[model samples]
Target: MARASATPRSSAYLSALSQEIEKKLQRALASPPQRRNLLQELFADVALEVDDRARDIILSREEDTISPADDSHLGQLCFYDVLADYYVQAPESGKPILDLIVQLWSQSFASHIFSLLFHKWLFEVQLDNPEVLLRYSSALAQGATNVFWIDIQTNTRRFQSLFCYLLDEVAVEPARLNKIPVQAQRDLYLLLSRFILFYNSGDKLDTFLKHCPTFPNAFLIGGPTDFFVTELADQLQKLKVEPVLLHYLSNLKVLQGMELRMATSTRLKTCLYSFTSPGGPMYPTRAVRHAAWDALDLLFPLFDWRSRTLHPVYSAHLQRRSTA
Candidate 1:
């Protein structure tokens, strides 16, 4: 059986489906059912297809993706390609998506682990093919590390949700449960932590701070305003990942969709940025980031359901910053 593999041709199919999904997402969100039945169905369809029979699947959810069928009903929606197009067509559709993302974040840590699992799968698949993997890895990071606010305006939900859910979930849980190799986990964590900043979870931050050994994955740690970079810095030091943080002294643009130059600082253009070691992870340079970001943007709301557990982000500028 030829499952959906990551080929240009198969991508063409997903690319088309994504467009329709974007259009439908608007209708679905504006008039969402009071119950979660229909949206949940879409989630199930995408999840099953991606998991059960996706061979040419350009991208899969993280290793620890949560299925809706999980014992606790804590399913994960980590496929950004499924939701990116929805974001492109209907930026306003993000409300429900955001609700779903927060729900995943707040409700089930196990479901979120799927994100990690998917990461392991993607990177591991690339290990034998060094040339292709490096580029794909970057695209994965850009979309994976994407924040919800960016998705509200652009089409990066599928990738963003997977990264955020995995990083946060892993950080919050006991490290003993992770069977993934240390080097691989550090590499993925570095990319995942870059644009992700979780608030109101005091000890969770503490836990992430504790596990970073040599600090190879510092790219994942950052200090965003409205929250506080210094606090993030302090936490990074406590967790022994300060070396990695220091390596990431300057922020690169990680958000893929932006005006380049917004009207004001408030509208500064942004792009997703990720680090790549030469001769390193999947899609080492361009392919991963480009393909994944494009696909994630292509699918948006449907694939990238926003978190239900997370509340609104109030933008209060402390000092100006940019991901560009």
Candidate 2:
């Protein structure tokens, strides 16, 4: 994705911000005992929501002055967001920070900072060294997974833009997706599958499934749709948040007519059914139970036939639930 060049004023402010980050990283590198603390603090600083004062300076315009309070499109902007762009514009400016990150790679928040700031750079630049490329790709996947889970656990869209960029820019773009190794590509796709619905990217479902990477275990897991549904079903089983679960259930309508393996279909069916029941196992709330029923009805309208075709005891259970 092409980003507009920052204005001279914003560029200078971003340069200062970059220097502050680098100084902290350098301190971390110089003091082994303080490395983790310093890196953690740096990560927190970059992740902070851009305040009004910082916003005005970092996003200043040539013609009109930007209002600190005018947070129409900049509400979600963070220091990392500005710095990420800064690094993209001046790749050299980020080399020092990147080197510091590599030295402190084992510490907490190191990968998080790298992923947030250099996600675009990782894909945009060409790395000739295979080992280095693999390491960076692995780090990107690991870091992205960590941040995405934060969004999931809090049921917040704080990282929605990040997810969108990975999906829209990296996942779908062949050239960009191919930049990473096969293993990393597979990992990236799997990671995206689990959170796609959470981030409300169901509209891109068709495109996403179409470009899914070829997994070595395709025979075991079936095709792209099957793998995606399997991941999604597993995600459903893990979701404790009612709103996020319901959001997922509601989005299952998109899977209506896709052909899936019988086992894969059963896996999804069993997952949704777990929530439909009132007790034990899933023990879903009333709202979730109803939503699951809706999803089941939409995905498997003919599932009722299974009650009659199966054992009498199971048939009675289904009969009672239908009336209940």
* Best-performing candidate as measured by lDDT: 2
lDDT of each: 0.34, 0.82
Q: What digit string (tens of lDDT, one per residue) describes model 2 on residues 4-113?
A: 45778888888888889999999988998988898888878987888988877776766654432232222587776667767877898899889989987887788888
| Cα lDDT of model 1 by residue, 25-107, tens digit | 44444454522444444444443424544432434434554222221112333344333322333334433443343333322
lDDT, model 2, position 178: 91
Worst 10 residues of 2 by lDDT: 65-74
Query: How far is 319's C-alpha from truth in model 1 (Å)?
Result: 21
Which residue runs does candidate 2 get wrong by more than 4 Å?
A: 29-37, 63-75, 302-316, 320-324
Q: After superposition, how far is residue 51 of candidate 2 from its true place, in Å?
A: 1.8
Worst 10 residues of 1 by lDDT: 264-273
TM-score of 1: 0.29
